[model samples]
Target: MTDTPWLTVVRGTAPLLLSIPHTGTELADLESRLSSPWTARCDTDWWIEKLYDFASGLGATVVRTGISRTVIDLNRDPSGASLYPGQTTTGLCPTETFDGDDLYRHEEDKPDAAEIEERRRTYFDPYHAALQAEIDRLRATHDRIVLYDCHSIRSVLPRLFEGTLPVFNLGTNDGRSTDPALQEKVRGILADTGVSYVVNGRFKGGWITRRYGQPDKGVHALQMELACRGYMREPGDKASPENWPSEYEAAFATPIREKLLTILQSAIAWANG
Candidate 1:
């Protein structure tokens, strides 16, 4: 067991690697810098790690970061460029929540350019390095490998997007991140479930999916951004910081979990093909 506090990596023999970047709640000393520590982590992919716990049994390697996205978003562009150019989104080190609430009490408490760069070195880099290492390790053993970037968000954040989001938002970087056939396979599975989904929709993949997904190199990457409502209770209309983020109940998520398991298994089958 490695003692690295920033992240956890579970090595598996499967050709699929699961990257759970935003599921972490640990704020370390950074929590003190937040005006609202709880809200700062309110956008976390709540219980997502546990939601996908069955991946390990399928032999899919899991690389998860324990550091909060409020500390440093491992999926954002490291150069400070926005992933969604004209749309609203957070930065490399988010200073606000998904609802556009300020995280710091004062401007002085916010991380400056120097601090952001240091965080990139400390938190962001290692997470990707581990992902890349796993990709490399798996690629050597299999003819093809899949880097499945797992994420989830609030069902509706008008500040970020209009109306509600679909249950599954698949991003293959507009078909540049993975093999076309692989994308179709996953889409086919979702179609069978009769659930709401969008391909190359609002989220067309992020840094990790865009950077490491090289189909020609035999490393296919895809990101599945699920609406939290699919697996947990997301209060409608009256959602406030205090009332939001309902507890995780396995029974409540069983239906969605079963669907997710099928999707993951499909990815593994595709990789092995």
Candidate 2:
């Protein structure tokens, strides 16, 4: 059990760090203020942590949070800067889902600046603190460390992207967040899988990748964004409110999971090299 009430961490000896920041769906005290449980949590990176459950066994230190993104997005820039300047993206405390659905019951119910700061202290700060601590711990022994941030989104969100996203979206801030060879290794793995994949595409990593990634300093970070449909049954063309987040079907997820297992293993191999 962890004494850090805000975040969850699993220690490992390897130089790989697995960060699952957006999978949390809990709203805590803010649940009453939000529109409803379902809408507020609709944008969550559903079951992303579970998708990477095998990382722990591979000796990758895992850091995650239980506070919903509606409360505070752990991967967003806490300073309220947009990760994608001109594009539509959620804030540190998102008031809307990816499809422009309101999260608060009323306009005023949305978190004010002071409340946002408070939530940052309560949720955001602890998560990054734990992540940094894990990186330091892993980097102490290994010459180089890899921080792999895990994420997933609905297959189609017109508000977010033009059409359905590819199966795997790898982001490295255009190769600045990690070694170019490491990115090549991952891209090679995805190529072998023979599925639709892209690197530094729509998602070119986020705050965690940009902030903690110092490849020149022996710390590398990468973000792997998976389209939910790749591993789950994504309703229909438009994943509406009622039929949105499909349940976690282990059998349905096996194929992509195998690819991901190899990706993670390859990351560790690159770090050790």
Residues 1-273 of candidate 1 have per-residue lDDT tens digits of 233877899999999999999988888687677987787888888899989999999999999998999999999999999999889999999988888889898899999999999998999999988988889899899999999999998888999989999999999999999999999999998888888999999999999999999999999999999998999998976457677779999999999999989988989998887
lDDT of each: 0.90, 0.89
State the local distance difference test value for candidate 2: 0.89
TM-score to native of every candidate shown: 0.97, 0.97
Model 1: per-residue Cα lDDT at residue 120: 89
Clashing pairs in 2: none
Residue 54, candidate 2: C-alpha displacement in angstroms: 0.8
Per-residue lDDT, model 1, residue 72, is 92
